[model samples]
Target: MSSRTTDGRSAATTAALLAGPIVMTAGMAATPWESENEITAYQAALAASPDQTQIAAVLLFFGYALMGLAFLSVLRRAGGAPRALRIPAATLAFCGATMLPGLVVVDFYDLALIQSLPAEQAAAVGERAGDYGLQPVMQVPAVAGLLLGGILVMLCAWRSGLVGGWAPALVAAGLVASFAVFSGVTMVAGASCSVVAYGGIALRLRSARIPSSPPAARPATA
Candidate 1:
């Protein structure tokens, strides 16, 4: 364990590791489909079920927040991973944690656009926003961060002997489904994988032993 890590921080690290993915996956599953440039219908859906869309956005935000919060622990807990491996993984994870979650803010903004603007005007701004937002400039790092970074972290975890095969396997499948397949069913499936990957990590973290430390650092003492 690092010098700064305390029982509360450790617990939070593990909890965030598990909870972030669960909430993010739930958000993905809950996400309403974007219209196929049918701006009118898109507006209508937002009008009809703004709650669902907003809820998805909210969930996604928390997911990202949890992930970002878990970043330090992820880096620290890479266990026996090499610096070469750790650097890139940490970079991607950082980008994902910081960038991806904030994208959900766009969802709320979209909802607001729909609610506040005239139908035609909302569509115009929405289309313009989507164009700028989904640009590869933003997506590449975001995807690399959340998806590839996560995959690598688990790989590092496996390498470090911190976890077994299931953790890496689950994260791989989960990332592919959540980001690559990018559909509702796949999202749900990916979310299931998230549960196993990070959640499994948390379980392993609990079961694993810590080196001797001050009492405040060990929750078992608490």
Candidate 2:
């Protein structure tokens, strides 16, 4: 295996990594579900439990943001992760940071629109939303960053020997499978794996210490 290196530089970041996935999993588990119709799914979920839906959205917002922030610590210099690996991974994580958290506002918007507007009217508004040029502009990067960026980071971390292969596999499987699984049960399971993967890394970081800088050379003796 490649050389391993770690520096527990920030306890806060390590905590974030551990907590982020747990919160996200809670959000996923808390999320409501019903008919699979894309157009009406959010509306139905909101109807089933408005408070739960809102709470889940809030949790997701904070969770994804913390995950992004925690990822930054992975990119810290002299950490043994290769420059080539770290650079792209960090860039993707940054891209995710730029918009992933903001995307959660759409959940609130969906709730508001479904509650205040007539069903057909709200549906019409949603359909028209797709017609706008800005729709894809805002959504594409956000989803890609969260999904692709997260997966790549794990890949790089594993390849660079910052983590074991299981770390990447667990996270990647959870992430990819989460997209395929429609039920909340599977969602919770997927997020559970994420928690295990990231939280395990955090545990390691919690115990790690940075290498001390080189000491100053003594002056020549007379």
Candidate 3:
């Protein structure tokens, strides 16, 4: 594999590895969403159909955190590519940073929900009881940040011509998917981010691997 390809793969793999804890931290940080708003429509859905809601939430957070890290890694890889690199990288970074604050809010909301719950309901859920509460204002920004970030990253991939490759496409697809999945809640944004994050990881991998030679254009001498 070419050095560029090698570097990209190494970076992406590293990002994926790093994403593990970030996802976990995000999950650990996010328990409050369900706990705090168990009665809300968003949480109510989960309450009614926890298998989908709970599992999807866990996957969404884990994916979102990983994508954030992956996007960051891609930007770092592009550091030497061109001045335009900053646009997407910055967008990704900004979105990731913006989303970070919501973690605190989610936790607080969870705590609030748990405190407000009646003893019976709280006890029924047992371990998850501590998560109940009303959501905080920060939820808005978190969702917005992810949506905006996903859009920005999509533009970045397109502009950078990274979209020509599978990696870029994956990132772009994930970001868009997130927009759909995260429709009503911050989790939709989170899901979109995760898809993009994995895409970024794929790009990183591509950057590090040896790509096959592009087809040569035939001569126009005739």
TM per prediction: 0.76, 0.81, 0.48
Give the TM-score ranking, best first.
2, 1, 3
Candidate 2: 10-residue stretch with minimal lDDT: 1-10
If both were scored by TM-score, which would come out higher, candidate 1 or candidate 2? Answer: 2
Which segments of candidate 2 are over 4 A away from where they belong?
Answer: 1-13, 207-222
- lDDT, residue 158, candidate 3: 49
Q: Sum up the clashes in candidate 3.
A: 20
Question: Model-by-model lDDT, in order?
Answer: 0.75, 0.73, 0.49
Give the per-residue lDDT of model 3 (tens digit) for 1-222: 687886766765666634743564355334324434324433433344434444445644555556565556545544444556567456645665546533633433433444567544544554454445543344555555554554554445445554444544554565566345543344434443444444554554565454578679888895
Model 2's number of clashes is: 0
Q: Poorest 10 consecutive residues of model 3 by lDDT?
A: 29-38
Compared with the true structure, what per-residue lDDT tens digits does model 1 show for residues 1-222? 664566666687777777777787788778776544376666766676789998988998888767765555666887588888888888898899888876767777767888998889998997786687558788789867987888778788878877788887887876666556555677678767766776666777766646566567545663
Taking all chains together, the TM-score of candidate 3 against the true structure is 0.48
Candidate order by lDDT, decreasing, is: 1, 2, 3
The candidate that achieves the highest TM-score relative to the unseen native structure: 2
lDDT of 2 by residue, 146-215 (tens): 6677777777666655678898788778776767876777678877887787766666555455435657
Pick by lDDT: which candidate is best? 1
Cα error of candidate 3 at position 79, Å: 5.5
Residue clash pairs of candidate 1: none
Off by over 4 Å in 3: 1-40, 49-59, 78-92, 97-137, 165-208, 211-222
